[model samples]
Every structure is written in structure tokens, then in C-alpha cells.
Target: MAPYSVYVRAVRLALEEKGVAYRLDPVDVFAKDGPPASLLERQPFGRIPAFEHDGFRLYEAGAIERYVDEAFPGPALQPSAPRERARVNQLTSILDSYAYRTLVWDIYVERVSVPKQGRAPDEARIQTALPKAQLCLRAINDLMDDGPYLAGAALTLADLHAAPMFAYFTLAPEAEALLAEQPAIKAWWASMSRRPAVQATAYPA
Candidate 1:
């Protein structure tokens, strides 16, 4: 599960959406002894959310999500139309490349993880990262339309990719304020959060 990892949450939600049964094995990447050798063998980087099914090994959240969507039989997570698929990929990329770092690393790690480890929140880091996080939210808002989901009317990989990150971001007061300015994104997030898949795979907050 990786505990609080958004990437792990994304994969777990996708699997739940597909109705795939699986077991979660939480890994502590920051353990004093380091990640287990088994995990390192499967994922060279010892990253969370690595999957192994019937001898098929996969890592990386994006690749794992796509594979789950295609490999399993259930509701399709991606659109059939080429343009819609592109839009899904585009939004997912934006979240992965921009929002993930600022929201998760700069804000969540500082405000949530640090405190949990008995350290105080890094106000300076949060202040430095808030503007960049705001920009990421604005970019997503600009890309999104009036549809109920990120890639349009139907939920797609884009929404799954974004939902977890947004969940964590909302925990940060500064990020929450920035999010309020983007009504469309806030509405979309509200819609995504209610889904059974999302609810089932929510991050442990």
C-alpha cells in the first residue's frame, strides 16, 4: 500500500474500479534498514505500488494503471476515441510531472510526514512551494471543461491519476485556498471523491 503514497492509491483505485481482487503489502521505503530485498528485486528503484500478477511484474504508476485497465475485464478506464485518450494522457502527465512534486513532496511531506516523524512542519518550504502548486492547479483548471470528470463526462485514467493527489493537497491549508479559486476543478474533485473506487482506495489520512 505504501501507506500514504498517492501513486499507490491511484493504482489501488484503478484495480478496485476494475473489480480486480488483490492483496496489499505495505512497504516502508524509509525504514532504518531500507526497503526489503524482495521489493528491490521487483522494482530496482524500490518504489511503491509495484505489481506482480501471474508472473507479470510491473512498476511505475502510469504503466501499471494502463496495464490494469487493459489486462483486466471491467469498465474501461480510458476512452475509445483517440482525442479523448490523448486528453486523459495529457492530464495524467500534468499531474505526474508538476502537481505530484509540489503537492506531495513539498507540502504533504513537510506538513504531514514531517510532523508524524516528530518534526515540525517546514513553513519556509511550504511558502516556497505554494505558488508553484497554485500554478499546477490553475493549469489543470484551464485544461478541464464543464464535464463531470477530467477527460470529459466519463471517469478515465486522468481522474484516477488526479484524485489521490488532490485528496492529499486538500489537507494543506495553503493548497486548499488555492484550490478554492478553481471552482471547476473543485467541482470535478467533489464528483471524483464520491466514486466507489475512490472511496475504497482513499489514502490513510
Candidate 2:
């Protein structure tokens, strides 16, 4: 699991939030030769953050987050009530299905990462993504009731799912204006960004 991957960081945040001790073995999926055979053995998709715990192996970030919360003995990362739990699941899904690609890959990668690599940003791509990114932010903001967190009063897997993406999305130049339109998410970031787990798993600057 690379420290820079949003999915990898999401899993790590769950572990940190749960007080679960673990080691991260780095896998470079973007290597010139393609993903290594060792990672392929653990995860056929060759994705970052293939996991193993007590001989039980897992791949997807969401599954691993739930596993860590259920298998560990720390503070609960999910709410017990069904409705709240549903909200957590909904928000997590939103981040995965909509927000991740629109905000992280479309905007962040084109606007920030590409520029860092000495490549000109794709202005047309960024322009096209702006509306979709705004929609994602609005959807998440609409789901919030009265909160310090995404799902509700308590911190849940939803926050962990989003924090990593937000970490990078905020670095994009377009983020300030988009986030300004969705104050709820912006405020959520202000608080979530300070958490020990988020700080611990932060992407390098």
C-alpha cells in the first residue's frame, strides 16, 4: 500500500481510528513494468492496499474498513443505529462513485499533480469536471443534517472515506470556489483535517 494512495490512506485511517496495529507494505501499481506478481497474488486487480488480518484477506477499501472496525476493540467507527449506519454507507458510496473520480482524478490530478510533473494541465478536462464536482459536493452537503461530521454527530467510516480525497481535492485551485458554495463540506474538512488519523495518513507535500 502506497502512502500516497487515497484508498490506501482510507484503510489506514480506519486502522488508526480503531487503534489497530498493522504494517503497510508498499506496492507500486504504476511501475513501468506493471504491477508486481506478488501484489497480483494478494489482489488480482493489482490495486493498492490489499489487506490481511488473522489470516483473513481482503481487497476493497470499504470492506477492509468495516472489517477493521468489527474485528478490533477500539472506539466504534460506525454507528449502531440502522438509519445512521445507512447514512454512513450512503456517504461512503457517494465518495466512491461520484466524488472520488470527479474531485480527485479529474480536478486534483489535472490541476495539481500534472502540473507538478511539468506537464500542462488539461484545461478542457478541468472545465468539464467542474460541474460534476460541484454536483458531488452538493449531494454530500444535502445529506448532512446538523453536524460536525458527514453522517451525523459521531465520526464514522464516511469521514474516513472522504478525508483522503478531500486532502488532495483541497490542493486544486478550483477547490476554494467549489467548497465555498458548499460550506458544510468545507467546515467538515476544517474539523476532519485536524484528526490524529487524518494527520497521520496525510499525503506528502
Highest lDDT against the true fold, candidate: 2
Of the candidates shown, which would achieve the greatest TM-score relative to the real structure?
Answer: 2
C-alpha lDDT values of all predictions: 0.86, 0.92
Local accuracy of candidate 2 as per-residue lDDT tens digits, 152-196:
888999999999999999999899999999898899999999998
RMSD of 2: 0.9
Q: Which ten residues in a row have the lowest lDDT in candidate 2?
A: 196-205
For model 1, which pairs clash?
A: none
- For candidate 1, write residues 30-98 as lDDT tens digits: 688888888898889977888988999899999999999999999999998998898999999999899
Candidate 2 stretches greater than 4 Å from native? none
Tell me the TM-score of model 1.
0.93
